[model samples]
Target: MAADLEQPVAGALPVKRTFLLIGTIVIAEPLAATILFPFIYMMISDFGTVQERYVGFWAGLITSAFFVPQMLMATLLGMISDRLGRKPVLIIGLLGSALCVFLFGLSRSLSWAILSRALCGLFNANAGVSRTAIGELAHNRGLNQGRAFSLFGFCNSIGYVIGPLIGGYLAKPAQKFSWIQSGNLFDQYPYLLPCVVSSLYSIIVSVIAILLLDETNQGISYPTLTGSTVSEETPSEALAEQDPLLTRLKVAAARIGPRNSTWYCIIGVGCVSLHAIIFDEIYPIFAASAGDHGLQFTSKDIATSLSVMGPIIFVAQLVLYPFLNDRFSSLGLWRTSAAVLAVVYPLFSLLPHISENHQGSSRIVQWVILLVLLAIRFTANVVAYTSISVLLNQVVAPEKRGTIMGLGQTAISLGRAFGPALGGTIWSWSLGNGLPPPFDFHLLYVIELLLALAQVISSLGLAKSQSVYL
Candidate 1:
């Protein structure tokens, strides 16, 4: 082990600009959503009048639509990055994303909204590119790979925290402008302000990236474990001679077969996406409904809850996760936390029913239940996500990092896309005559149970799979 540690690992080409490139992209992509989400329901409601119960479905789609295209395109983007240095690809993706944000501001119909978001997905390769770029940059700079990944996660959490605050406050005009009525401007032009802000941010960040970010795909030159040296005659030729391991991994992941890491990750992330769809996509609807049971919450209140959630998540990632990971393996953390969610998510589904059924009781009961639900879900999320991230960092080889990371990103996007639709469909189904109060409770419970089972399976599979550890 000591000899292996002494062995000179592949050295990455030092690039200071890589940090700016990574940080800017890391901050921009999530900012697009955080700023836009506060007014998503308003956008949907503005587009069309939705039934009270089905509102969750509409809100859920806002998230799902944005992610689906990214999910579909991640592998291709990863492959492209490997072939054509990361900078050009990053520029194209960011430019496309900026265009999408502008288009989202201009969208006047639901179809247009969907189209714009899908386009954003297609171009939103920032996360994947940054991950690949940073990994190479880190290796070149002689930085620890796990630490590099942790830095990305840390920056992401910070973005998540700040973005929502910007959305919650900055996106909204105080008392409306001179020509616009107090609330009419924001209500009528739901995505207008936020989207514009997002576009400008993307453009600025992209410019910085273009000027500063250097290409790391100079021909590979490194000593292998077997004493063989790897290199390319020219940087251009490097693409054609990429390690076979990356190719095999991509082939394995992209296959329709259910046994690969892609499938497990897809299923795992899909389960998590469903809850996000429920909590984020559905919660606003429930918040709106709070008045019937006297829990009255405005859009601002909902925004506040979301904003708080982001920071809390950031703290968990930064302060709590390292300690937790020290005690529990990623798979162990995933299984244990998922088991908690299996129980907690369904109980959460019952809150609205309690509010509706016990109308004469104090509304504090419902509020307490809501808070507890949020706490449990958030805790589970912190534990499960950090574990997965650490595992992703540990599992694959440096050469295949780009493709593997993209695979995970793609799975997340796909899950995020479909999750809302599933939540909405279930919510819609449960609102009918023969069902129990808060009709969707059973569906939420069932989905979570299925997810827990999949988590267990994934844990076992991951434990058996081979990995490279530093």
Candidate 2:
């Protein structure tokens, strides 16, 4: 019994509790999002009275709104965690997230939904704080950094897998639940069930964290680098006296210099994220619209098509990425991924065109083309997701990981917010006043090409800059 007590807790945690916490946070939001995604078009049709063409556009805004505040405040939240502790941030984020989920169920108007989404985005930095806490824990246990990140990725991937599947299955039943029916009982109330589930998950995690989680940030009192001329209190003492949350945020942000490799890496990450946003925002709409021309598929078919890419991504991260990272420079991976993405968008544009023009070709040819496009898109996703996060990890120090990740999250959020609006406007324009078949495809290809160019420019810029790690 004494020997059991004497054994360190770290070994036990990675096997059980740590993974559970990470898995809960990762899976809950995505599961909720997935449930809503399949139903989004239905809700927009019922509630917003919008056309099918605009479903993706409006859905993008709503989804992006949920992440905007997270992106905007991610750096600040991370910095705060660095100063005072990760536990408080984790608690606050989970609690706030749950409230936001509840409000989402309660929202009566589109405007109310938007407001609630923004608020949820504001405190959604729980993921970053979790990463920082885990990183610190890993460091203390003498675990490898890459492996730590991979473990975190694995937890999130599991969530990604379960979230969509559950969401698709639960969409209709959630609407009929008694409480949701009594309130607004609209056609889309089914989405409320997933939100309820997510909120409960958050509350449960918060309770568990409050009891079991410790202050893993152990180096808060390291002297500031601004030459001991000023008499600032030690970080630990300051944390003790102040509203530790806000004070720590301010101090950590102040310490982070603008011109460091970390900032450059963040900029690069933001640029890469922009293309991802645009592609993701645009693709579903494009796929759905294919129904109008020659391609036949429902919105659910589109969801399943995209969902197939998730496992492809998992395989790359698990089997392909480490080998690629070892054999080639991170920059090499970035360049290769960008090149493939740049070429593939134009090919995607050709799919519908071939469907219309190929008189002699069998139906199998078109399906084959679509399948190939999905494959290319899947490969692009694998490369981007794995490579960017890995490179970002290498550029920043462990102390600054949370803040930097917050900034990266913010960029992604901004992309989500704006990308759809931009794509919708373009799509709306291309479909304008009776434009012929393939016009939307042409417009999308043009936008994707521009994004590809932007990625290339950013990659070149990254190459020229001195490697922070090397």
Which structure among the candidates has the greatest lDDT? 1
Overall local distance difference test of candidate 1: 0.61
lDDT of 2 at 67: 62
Candidate 2 Cα outliers beyond 4 Å, as residue runs = 1-20, 29-35, 51-53, 105-108, 134-143, 154-164, 173-188, 211-215, 220-260, 290-296, 353-372, 433-439, 467-470
lDDT of 1 by residue, 271-348 (tens): 664555455555555555543322345566666666666656666665676566656556677678778777776675
Question: lDDT per prediction?
Answer: 0.61, 0.60
Give the Cα error of residue 294 in candidate 1, in Å.
10
For model 2, give the 10-residue run with minimal summed lDDT. 1-10
User: Which residue pairs show backbone clashes in model 1?
Assistant: 12-139, 12-140, 64-417
Q: What TM-score should be assigned to candidate 2? A: 0.75
Q: In lDDT terms, how accurate is model 2?
A: 0.60
The TM-scores of all predictions, comma-separated, are 0.77, 0.75
10 residues in a row with least lDDT, candidate 1: 219-228
